[model samples]
Target chain A: MKPEEHQRRFENTDTLINEPIMAVDITRYCDWLAIMFYYGAAHLVDKHYAMRKRPFHPDNHSQRVDESRRLKRGNVVYKEFLLLYNAGLNARYEPIFYDQEDVKELKESYDAIKSILLTA
Target chain B: MESTLALSQSYKGLIADSILNILPYTLAKDQSNLLETPWGRHMGDGSYYTYNLLESVRQSIVDIPWWTIGESNNMSQDTCETELLDRLINGLLAFATTEKVIISQREESIAFWVVSSALDIMTQKKYCYFFADIVDKEFDTEYIFDFRIVSPSNRDLKRIPTDAQVYVRR
Candidate 1:
């Protein structure tokens, strides 16, 4: 809830999405993919909330992404958030393996949002 | 200012593309009215509209299981799309009107799934909407899709009928 705590969590998630995600390969790593994707997204949202000095609540993630986009009133970032949110949902809920092509798509979405986050 | 406007347009286009991606195309019977291929997953062998784009979405949400851990056969890339088309036809019978409805899907998860009641619209020659699920999160809050989505070119909007009217259900 503290601002420093939120900052640490944000750094931690930024590392989670970037570093740990690279460990996943074409063979079998979907469970981690889905969890980290959702966490990465949720933490980005938490970063938004933390900027406003609000505690993070971990529910209705789609709502959070949309709301945060509205909060910042940014354009390209909204689509990035949408990609992350939707991709996260697919990764989390589905019981399928994310192939090379899938990871490529995830990487595109991940890169878009992560770049925006790092600069922010 | 120009950069801001361009990004705004880009966001809206992506929004529309996402909406169009998960949707089914109403088969214009006899193939007399339209071209065959808008690309494989966009329109099918001229008979079926490309409903299952790379196995991420389905023609009928009825086939999409409520639980994530269902059987694996449907998840395969090679899963026959005709199976999804068949489910849509069977599912259409529940409605009184025959208008076949479809949704757009470019993303991994679409919160809004529009089911057309399109047969009745075409047959009776009218626009109609029902049960905009606003209050209940357990159900659908998908807004009544304007004719913009169903018209010929998803981008051009050249042939959309002018007499569209919404008949909101009580």
Candidate 2:
């Protein structure tokens, strides 16, 4: 996908991060929130890579992460992207729910990734 | 045929030796009678459920050092174990060299041990599979490890192995 398309997808779901606490059960939404944060971060990574003249489109999450680790700003991307991937995996597969605190921590990672990749 | 047989023997020896090393750890963790667990049933009938090679590959992990996952909120033991296992696998895979690494499954729990005949047998490799019915059967079930990423999709066995060379200390 084009960098613009990837960025648009990220921004589209990025809006869900602010879903009204009163409207829905935050606990139930924890999984959704984590996944949104993970993919949001993922899209940012994809966008940054896409902007390269020789685009890097990793076919899978692991590939995306492994390839991103070799990027110029690999250290930040590697750590934050991995944390998001694991958090999203746990939320979706394991019976674990992201408490508000866990979600908040994940959001910090997302923001860090956004600040770095969005600027790049 | 002789070469194939030799290769098979070598693989079993590697697996059995690896299990023997981690057996004490599992026992120390009070993971006895692992054959009694539901996962034990999945492992196989208790035909070879002893300290011997065929019987010793039952328990996947033992003595997990549990730490709090989230602050002020203690996660359940299951969650804690799962998280730690995830970390351990990820760490091992990330740092692992593409050597002859073995992945063993004990019921639902899984462990990875990087074994090389070139290394001293006494130089421990910290990976285990306990409660074995048949070494061949269990080996058939095991996945070859490198440092493949665990994604939701693309779970093909062939593509799973990544270049792993982790030296996890005891």
**Best candidate according to DockQ:** 2
TM-score of chain A of 2: 0.88
Q: Model 2, range B2-97, lDDT digits (tens) per residue?
A: 342233234444444465555554455356645442322232554323433323353321221111111112112254444443445444433333
Compared with the true structure, model 2 gives a TM-score of 0.48
For residue B36, model 1's alpha carbon misses the true position, in angstroms, by 49
**How well does candidate 1 score on lDDT at residue A50?**
61
**Per-residue CA lDDT of candidate 1, range B1-170, in tens?**
23422332344334334434443343322255666435444443343334344333433332422211111112221223324322332333235543333322222222222223332112111221121111111212231111211211222222222211111111
Q: Whole-model Cα lDDT per candidate?
A: 0.39, 0.48
By lDDT, who's the top model here? 2
How displaced is residue B26 in candidate 2, in Å? 21
TM-score of chain A of each: 0.70, 0.88
Q: What lDDT is reached at residue A16 by model 1?
A: 61
With candidate 2 superimposed using the best TM-score fit, by how many Å does residue B7's alpha carbon deviate from the native? 20
